[model samples]
Target: MAEKIIIGITMGDPAGIGPEITVKALSNPAIYDRCSPVVIGDACVMEAALTIVGKENVKIHPVSNVDQCLFTPGIIDVYDMKIVDINKLEYGKVSVMAGDAAFLYVKKVIELALAGEIDGTVTNALNKEAINLAGHHFSGHTEIYAEYTGTKKYTMMLAHDNLRVVHVSTHVSLREACDRVKKGRVLEVIEIANKACLDLGIEKPKIGVAGLNPHSGENGLFGREEIDEIIPAINAAKAEGIIADGPVPPDTLFSKARGGWYDIVVAMYHDQGHIPLKVVGFIYNPMAGKWDAVSGVNITLGLPIVRASVDHGTAFDQAGLGITSELSLVNAIDYAIRLSKSERIK
Candidate 1:
């Protein structure tokens, strides 16, 4: 194969806007120009999406493997997972079928990546609640990729230019998230973030780890977590020559990252990191009652196989209204391609 970067794009929750966005995204001939893009999803659903979006000329190419792909414009190469009964999929409703199918799309992409069938993967948004409801029980795409790819060590890297962040605890309850801010996990994630920064072409990255408590436990005035777990973690990472600092106030560390003081920040939990990133990335339109744009890609840092995703969830409410935006999906594909390129060069 000619280092032919076969990019596998998983169509997310069919009940949501996954099909719509996948269709809309490939309307660009340039996506095919950069890489031979394939969709690990349903053909009938994509057909509906194309019709809904009114791009009747856009055609779907079903392939058994990426090697058989035609890198042609106006045509999408889809590996038919055949997991949905489109009649049963209520546009905006969560279904076990949708959840299971979403899980399969992701799972197959990993298998193909490991088997060298695809060079990289760009995942669309999947509904966590739906996945769990179907008993697939993953927190999100990061965990799913980490587990299936047999990546024992991995970190979630959220990036948009210099406003990058990695998390120590994601997908846990608030109290559990607080408890998980131990030295070992903290140090692990710090190292992961550092490596990720290097992957982003930063030679020597500066990382600021956010404290688990307010005012970094206020120097034991408010809490002792900083004294007990966080501080030790920072010491460990620094001891090994990682430019890690923090137990800094969470409120201030983000501003520092935004101001270019640090290459990235390590957040304690999912929302802690995600909130600031979305605030910077997601563009909302109140009048239209929609998010008009999203600018960040969620990269799984320690995976053996390359995976990146839209930093948004399944827009179940906007399923086939024909206004779903593929900008985020397109961004995810671009980032996946870039990461794959970086890894290939190494």
Candidate 2:
């Protein structure tokens, strides 16, 4: 049998659903069959999560280092950072304490990945407002990973089953996002999207680039971005022998991509990409007053280390409720393992 991939999972905001989902996802023995998983967070938080999820069979084994992890199916080996005081943390609320703890956990995991101590890292949801309140002023996980890993050129790829999308710009104002969509940046993201598909096992990725304007500028009637920037980039990409096409109309791009017409869609901005992916991944049950499933993986491309994250946020409303679904976290772990294994083979 092949050796199991060791995945480092960062416990996100203590006040959020991070702990609950982490514990629930790890309860399945099948996870251990694929990889040796370790949680990098407060031991007390994980213990509370275990209780909340009623996973009595699973024990939280606190380890000071990764080497001490047991990698057992019924046990959750945690590299306890001991950053949060469970007594001070409140469910369904944001606090600086939780934010600081979440930041520290992510920082530690990134350090471990850089040192080759972990094959790849999987992140739970962290609260952006809380993190900023704690003084770690960054946009989100993608920025944090890029900064700590010294990665200058990186893009966020959201995947749900076969429908995948990559952003040209994320976490920026719409105006700023629009301004940032130049040929250089558009072409850069297209290349990253292609490479991301390869990492996900696509031999020759067919990429569809979304236009920034209506009707792809209708040949420069509505906007000049397509003629001046987007199309130029597509031409540049084709010249480089990449199987890319578009400045496709945004209205129809996602439908085609979802139907397998393209391996990946190069969204001009964040919402253009995220909305379609989320619509498919997020499942809500109004009658039940809860989410039935939150299933998607967010992969960071053009980084030295492999990282996959849940394509959802810190559901503070559901924290400590034990009702949150772990599907997204599970998917994230699967992506981490696939990306890590692919990296090893290359």
Candidate 3:
């Protein structure tokens, strides 16, 4: 059998559900069969989470470096960053200390991946407000990874089952999102989306580009973005031998993509892509009064190293309750493994 890939997982906000879900996900022995997983966070934080979740069999093996990891099934090897004081942290609350700790964990994991110490990186949910509060001043993980890796062009791709969507403009206001939808940016994202699909095992990805306006501007009746920017981008992508079809109406694009009409959809903005993915990935039971499942993986495209993250955020309300789902983290790990394997082959 081939050796398992080493996946470095960043424990998100220490006060959030990140440690809880990381412990829960690593508890399953089958994960060891696929990859050697390591937690890049404070060992004390993970210990608290294990106590909260009541996962006793799993042991936290603190390590100073990757080579110190045992890769054992029941033992979770944690590269202890020790950036936070466990006594000061309170679950379900956002603070600068927690934010700084989370940021440090992610930075360390990225450094490991780039240094060839780890095959890929998987991130748990981090609170944006808390991170900003700590003066990191980045919008989210994608932005941080891009800046740290010196990647000039990158896009966020979210996947759930067969539905895949990539964004042209994320972490921007709605008005700014529309303004950023020019031919150059749109085409750049399309290229990234195509390459991302190929990395995920698609030989020739079918691309669907959503329009910024209604009915793709109704032939210039609603807006001219399709006629002016989107169509030209699609034509240029085709000219470059990319299998792309777009300027599709935003209303219909997702439905078609969900039905497997396209391998991926190039969404015009953040909400345009996120709303649909969350609709299908997030499951809430009204009577249960909590989420039954949250399943999706967020992949960053056009980077030197591989990164896959949970689609959900830090559920402050459900932090210490131990009800946060590990399904998304598991999916993100699966994606990281696939992408890492593809990168190795290339």
| Candidate models: Cα lDDT each | 0.86, 0.92, 0.93
List model 3 lDDT by residue over 1-346, tens digit each: 2277999999999989999999999999999999999999999999888888899877999999999999888899999998989889998898999999999899999999999999999999899899999999999999999989999999999999999999999999999999999999999999999999888889989999999999999999998999999999999999999999978999999999989899999999999999999999999999988888899999999999999999999989889888888999999999999999999999
Q: Report clashes for each candidate as comma-separated counts.
A: 0, 0, 0
Higher-lDDT candidate of 1 and 3: 3
In order of appearance, the predictions have TM-scores of 0.95, 0.98, 0.98
Q: List, residue by residue over 1-346, the lDDT tens digit for candidate 1.
A: 3555778999998888888888888889888767778899888788888998999998988877777777788988888888898888788888899998999999999999999878899898888888999899888998888788778877888887679889887878998988888889988999989887777678999999898778988889888888999899999999999998888799899989999999999999989999999998889999988778867888888889889888878877778898867887888888888778878888
Model 3: lDDT of residue 337: 96
State in Å the error of residue 319, model 2. 0.6
Predicted candidate 2 versus true structure: per-residue lDDT over 1-346, tens digit per residue = 2278899999899889899999988989999999999999999999999889899778999999999999988899899998888788899798999989899899999999999899999999899888999999999999999999999999999999989999999999999999999999999999998888888789999999999999999999999999999999999999999999888999999999989899999999999999999999999999998889899999999999999999999988788889999999999999999999998899
Clashing pairs in model 3?
A: none
Relative to the true structure, candidate 1 reaches a TM of: 0.95
User: Whole-model lDDT, candidate 3?
Assistant: 0.93
Runs with alpha carbons beyond 4 Å of true place in candidate 3: none
lDDT, residue 231, model 1: 94
